[model samples]
Target: MNAVPFRRIGFDIARDVLGKPDILLLDVRDPASFERGHIARAENASPINLGRFLTETPKEKPVLIYCYHGNSSQAYAKAFSESGFGEVYSLDGGYEGWATANARAAAAAPRLSETLKAFLIAQGFPPDDVNAVGKNQMTPLMQAAHLGPAALVAELLAAGARVDAMNSDGSQPLWLACVGDDPEIVALVIKAGADLEHKNVNGSTALMYAASASKAKALMALLEAGADLTYENDGFSALDMAGSRECLDLLRAAQRRLKAAS
Candidate 1:
């Protein structure tokens, strides 16, 4: 059976649909509010991001949308539906409504596991430091950047995980993104205000990591973002770390341009 489009679902239904892997949850709210908080794994809808979502998201994936008071979601739902999406839903009361409903449910909800709390303590985090990280201080955002569907990275960034939080060894999330080799995630971090030239303990910049990992797209994104090719990590410039011929060519070409412009 074909699923209905622009269906407004209450909290109960919304909750169930959220667990589905194929569902695309979108929060159609402003960036600041999204940074404050929103549904887990939910992508924030901004003008530019919405265009990308509409372009890239598969039409078959069911779309679940919510907004501040729920009214705006219906309009967004209509747009998604008209754009040929198969299943699109709007939260009945929007985020505010969902919050109210969720609060009511949590009142009787089972207590959260102390196992996680214990694990956090063992990992060297202070008892109240609820930020997900181990003794190494690699936040969830860092892990997701290094390995992701790219959506999780976006969700974490929207939910205000510090984009530039470095690990014990001083590896930034942007560096991990280069290891992951996803240009899209690199761009996402860049948009989230990652310092392109911020170096680690060894002074390796994101560009250096990208070159070492060997992918034209990731390296290209950093180069296009104006990453400093001159900055050497432990005296190893990105040119020295170039793993792909394409990246090498890009570095050389970008270098010549820099010289000409200077």
Candidate 2:
């Protein structure tokens, strides 16, 4: 018998699949079990009718299959894979496992909300002392920059967080944003007046970070923002750190343009 490729689904995976618009959840259990309690939007297609159901259902969408204790689902998942379904999953512990995990998450819901609220408040408020550091010696602005959430970065900046504040390792917010490779977040910090030329402990700048991370869009954004290409750290310029061929070509062309202009 040929092996069929199928993923083993856990509660986390099932929950993620539920949110996708193009997902098909299959409950292979008997009618009574499905009617008692099944995942929202799941379809009941018992083993006997599975062939007919497969003929009607779209194969391109992800299919998540589950039975009483997951054993039956594995057989169904293999069948679907053999029939050329691109994405097939067998729920590891079946519907029973999903129900138990959901209950646990529900019980912790209030604590999760409070923790989220505290995080939001910390980003929105100004630091009591501008130089104050957290556990890792990272100020609020530095931490926000590393996360690459444009809204949080904006909130921190608006709260009077210093754009040039350095972490313990001497990395600035712009450098951290470049490391995250998010052009929008990088642009946000730039618009908020972050220093494009500021160097970290190793003397590397934000442009170097973008190049090293192979972030072509971010590298382009840095170039358009007028980052100095000639600047070098330990004798290695942004051109040297350009990890992708596309970024290397862009850096070389930009360097030529800068030289010509000078």
Candidate 3:
């Protein structure tokens, strides 16, 4: 039997991921098509390897599958979901919808890397204006950390923008990134030196936010980056407000690290 291309969701693959951070994008299109252009953070999976993709996929995570036309992939989605992949969704219109939404009519020339760099420089960025813009108390860096391209975030960091710089409510870009469920973006900010210990208005740490949202990957990443376990928000440490056993376990592990360090 041939594989399914489309499932139940109402849009193409790129739009699906663009709308939500928690959704994992599984592009089943051909390698050439995928290499030409694809959504950010999307992974390639040939329809022929259906069983392999299904086995590797996490049950706890939501899966959004798609292909070139939304036809063959549709059948595959149903079969896989019934086989036990709960929360499986397919791109309704397939790559056709994606093309209609994103493809330009004619071939547009790609910008040279040097030109792009100069454009960014002309914008007065990367530590020059990023921090100056934040002097008004509005965190442009935090806003950039929310979405992709990450150019602004880079600019701010180069400009010496505080990685631990907090918003009016004490929420740093790292904390906001976690709350937004952007593990990739969160990782970038942390790599740029985002302070895990910084708290928000409620004194909630990024770890606490990841715990409340059941974001296992985010939670683990925060812990590995050395987020403080004993740090309390308002009055509760992350463990005090953790929603599940997994979260509690993470806090316990963090506690052990603290004891060992001491």
Clashes found in each candidate (C-alpha, N, C closer than 3 A):
0, 0, 13
* Model 3 clash tally, residue pairs: 13
Ranking by lDDT: 1, 2, 3
Q: Cα miss at 159, model 3 (Å)? A: 4.5
TM-score of 3: 0.43
Residue 43 shift from truth in candidate 1, angstroms? 36
lDDT at position 14, candidate 1: 75
Better of 2 and 3 by TM-score: 2
lDDT of each: 0.77, 0.75, 0.64
Residue range with the least summed lDDT across 10 consecutive positions in model 1: 126-135
lDDT of 3 by residue, 132-193 (tens): 22332335566666643455456556544456655556677787667655666777789987
Q: What's the lDDT of the predicted structure labeled candidate 3?
A: 0.64
Q: Show where candidate 1 strays beyond 4 Å.
A: 1-130
> By the lDDT metric, which is better: model 1 or model 2?
1
The per-residue C-alpha lDDT of model 3 at residue 126 equals 33
Q: Estimate each model's TM-score.
A: 0.50, 0.50, 0.43
